[model samples]
Target: MAVVKVDKKGRLVIPQEIRERLRIDETTPLIFEVDDGNTIRIRIIQRDDQAYTSDPLWKAIHNPVFIGKKVSKKELDEIENDQWSN
Candidate 1:
């Protein structure tokens, strides 16, 4: 229900109210579809329960501290277990 301008770079800034209502965050993924070359539909890709629970482990594996280094499965398992144990 809101009209927004597409910037020169073709990026649209979603309004704050809409973002808050839709619970959109920086990490959120969106699917954009064009229908009849006139209507644009945006769908938010939501993470399932399992993905939500493992988010911490995913983040830890990609953490800046591990950048440019290969983390072993054992190390990842330890990190995941450590998070749950605490």
Candidate 2:
């Protein structure tokens, strides 16, 4: 088990091993919540927007929104290399 100390400024530095395991870094976005006891729980936002750029379904729905119209099925097929129907 790992133990951490909160500094005078109320900041706790997570251990390096834990950070690496959870893929947390300086720029990582997080969501903080509290339980009934008011202890805070922190979660890493793994996807945020990076996945939207490369994830096929997300691209299919969002790509054309940038140009102000729904894309043609043909264009979508081309983007998916004709495998979108499958």
Candidate 3:
């Protein structure tokens, strides 16, 4: 158990030991919830590189959309071949 102080900006730093044990990094996403109007629960969402690659929803959320003109399959293949040859 660890006691943390909330600063004026409402930010509390998790202890180093806890962070190390949980493998929490800067990219980690945390979910905070108040339980029973008294207890606060912090849920850590941990995912590996493989998870992001395998999960379609994650890919959809992170992948950028094509907004410009649409190219045909032949055009795309030609572009790929040209890049590979160079």
Best by lDDT: 3
- CA lDDT of each candidate? 0.83, 0.77, 0.85
* lDDT by residue for model 3 (7-59), tens: 99999999999999999988897778899877999988656656546778878
**Total colliding residue pairs, candidate 1:** 0
Order candidates by TM-score, high to low.
3, 1, 2
Query: Candidate 2: deviation at residue 45, Å?
Result: 1.4
lDDT of 2 by residue, 26-49 (tens): 978676788768577886766656
List residue ranges in candidate 3 displaced over 4 A: 48-61, 64-66, 69-86
Clashing pairs in 1: none
Residue 18 error, candidate 2, Å: 0.5
Candidate with more favorable, higher TM-score: 2 or 3:
3
lDDT of 3 at 12: 93
Instruction: Name the better of 1 and 2 by lDDT.
Output: 1
CA deviation > 4 Å runs, candidate 1: 49-86
Instruction: Please write out the lDDT profile of model 1 over residues 23-86, one tens digit for every residue.
Output: 9989997779898779999988777645644677766666647358888999999999998999
